[model samples]
Every structure is written in C-alpha cells, then in structure tokens.
Target chain A: MTRIAEKFVEEFYNSFTSEVLTAADPAEVVDRYYAAEAVQIADGIEIDRDKLIAHLRPVRKNLVSWRYEVHEAVREQEQLAARFTIHAQLRKGRMLSTEVHLFAEFAPDGRLRRATQLTRDVTPQTPQDVTPQTTEAAPQ
Target chain B: MTSRELRVLGMTCAHCVNFVTEELEHLPGATAVTVDLPTGTVTITSDQDLGLPQLQAAIEEAGYDLAD
Candidate 1:
C-alpha cells in the first residue's frame, strides 16, 4: 500500500506538471485528475475547477521547466498524503523551489475529490541547476 | 508540566494532525498534545523537557519535519 501510494503521488505530479505546462488544453489535464466536484485549498485559499484552469494559464505561459522530488508519501484508505519539493524554472532566469505538504481524497473513480496543500518557499541549493527545457518556447 | 511549542512543516490535513499528535503523545513524558493543522503548530505538554532530537525524531517518524 505504501509503495502504491508513493508511486501514485510520483506519477500524478509528474504527469500533471508536464501535461499542464505543455498541453494545448490544460483544462483537460486538470479534469483528468480532478473530479467534477473537486476542491483544492492551498494555503487557505479555495480553488475550484474554474479557478484551477485560470491559474494554469499563466503557469503554462511562464513556466519553463519543473520537477518534483517526493520525500515521503502514504495512504490510508481513500486518503493520500505526501511531502514533496517542486523545483520550477521560469522564463527570464527566475527559479522557484517550494516544499509542499499535500493531503488529498480520491473519489471512487480514482479522480481527486478534495485536496489541501501547505507550501513554503525554500532556497534552492544550486539555482543554476535545472531540468531540461520543455518544447514550449520561452517569452522573447 | 513543561509545554513546548514547535512549528512543523508538511502537515496539511486532519490526518496529518492526528498522526503528529499520536506520535507526540507517545513520548515518555508527554501528557497532552495539541496540533493546529492550518498553522502546523504543535504544543506538547510533558513532564520533562524534550530535547530537539527527541522532538525531531517523533515528528520525522510521523512523516513531517520541523521548520527551521
């Protein structure tokens, strides 16, 4: 169960970040992972489906590359919890490293029903190190 | 009793609060454990002064970390 939970967390973020940042229709990517009634709260701000899609627009435009480092993940029944860090490189040499604690509940069909996230910015040890750039072009 | 307040990182839900509270409650002299999920603040009431290592170990065991 632990391994499965960890694998799910890794795959979910990996696919979500990659697809959302590059997909022609990022809303489709959001719908794929989140149920119709899904709700996400990040740092006390509530985000519904429409809000999520709206937030993705800027991310797809400005985000250059990103990756997740999952420190730990666990599951108990339909609830999943994970601790991870996201290293994201943006256009014009901007970088963001954030440590995230996420807790989520899955619907019967495997889509996310609800999620809460707590995040804090962390200084990257090596800001120059970044993942390879995606196919999306950076702003000129 | 000695009350210790700590800021824990990576606790986002009730489950996390319960996990952390349970871990802290298991400490040798812990008499009460209060975990605030939104702020990631944990207040532990114990009979003895718990060292940093001991607190860190308990929080780490619950799959969380102490905020630096």
Candidate 2:
C-alpha cells in the first residue's frame, strides 16, 4: 500500500506536468488523471472539471518547464496523502517554487475523485537566483 | 471526561477532518472528536488523558502527522 501510493503520487505529477506542458490537448490529460466529477479545493477555493480545464489552458500556454519533488506519500484504502514541492519555470525567465500538502480520495478506477491542497511559497534566497513556482492559480 | 487539543499536519479539507475524527473516535475511552480545518487543530474528549503515542498512532493511521 505504501509503495503503491508513493509511486502513484510521483507518476501522477510527472505525467501531469509533462502532458500539460507539451500536449496539444491538455484537457485530455486532465481527464486521464482526474474523474469527470472530480473537485479540487486549493487553499479553500473550489474548482470543478471545467474550471480545472480552463485553469490548465493558461498554464499550458505559459509554462516552460516544471518538476516535482515529493517529500512523502502515504495511503490508506482510497485515501491518499502527499507532501511535495513544485518548481516551475515560466516565460520570460520568471520562476516560482511552492511547497504543497495534498490529500485526495481516489475512485475505484484509480482516478482522483476529490482533492484538497494547501500551498506556501518557497522564498528564494536571492532575487537573481529565484526558484520556480507551481503555475496552478488556486494557491495564489 | 478530559479534553485534549493538538495540531495535525497535512490536513487540508473536511475529508481529512472526517478521517482523523473517525480514527480518534476508535481509540479506547474517546467520546468525541472535533476538528478546526483552517487551523489543523483537533480536540478529542476521552474518559482519561490520552498519551502522545496513542494520539500519534491514531493521527498517523488517519494519514497525517501530529504536529510537534
């Protein structure tokens, strides 16, 4: 259970990052990982599938590159929990880094049924060496 | 009954509150569980004072960390 959950967390972010940044149809990418009825609340705001798709459009357009560093992941039955950091590089040399704590419930088919996340910006030590941040707008 | 309050990490939603409440309620002597989601504070009422290990175990079983 532990290993499976950890691997799932890693793969989910890796796939989402790669596909959303490069795929011509990013909505299809969202569909592959999240259920049609999936709801995500980040920092108390809620977004359903259509809103998520709308959110991904600008991300796909502006994101240059991104990566995840998963610190921990665990699962009990269908409940999954993870703590990770996202480093994103955007257009025009802007960067942002954020640490995230996420909890999610998965459907029987392994797609996300619902998720809630809390994120905090990771301040870079110096202005000239700023790190990347997640492009997901909900955390801002 | 005695009441204990503690902070838990990685709890970001109502579902997390449910999971923690359910697990803590299973502990021996526990009577009630209340969670403050925004602050990640959980208050548990029980017949006797709960030990740190016992509380830690329940929180961990719910897939969260008991804040130090």
In terms of lDDT, the best-performing candidate is 1
Tell me the tens digit of each residue's lDDT in model 1 across A58-122. Answer: 45555577777788899897899999887767644556677889999998877888999988767
Per-residue lDDT tens digits for candidate 2, residues A1-140, read 66666767866777777767766887887887889999999879677988777666545544566667788899897898999877666543455667889999988887888999987767375533333334331100
DockQ of each: 0.02, 0.01
lDDT over C-alpha atoms for residue A30 of model 2 = 84
Cα-based lDDT for every prediction:
0.76, 0.74
- What are the models' TM-scores? 0.61, 0.59
Q: Write the per-residue lDDT of candidate 2 for residues B1-68, one digit (tens) a residue.
A: 89999998766434355557767887899999999878889999999889989999988766578888
True-vs-predicted CA distance for residue A35, candidate 1, Å: 0.5
Candidate 1 chain A lDDT trough over 10 residues, lowest sum? A131-140
List candidate 1 stretches off by more than 4 Å: A133-140, B1-68
Q: Which of the CAPRI classes, incorrect, acceptable, medium or high, describes model 2?
A: incorrect
Which pairs of residues collide in model 1? none
What range of 10 consecutive residues in model 2 chain B has the weakest lDDT sum? B10-19
Steric clash pairs (candidate 2): A96-A132, A96-A133, A97-A132, A97-A133
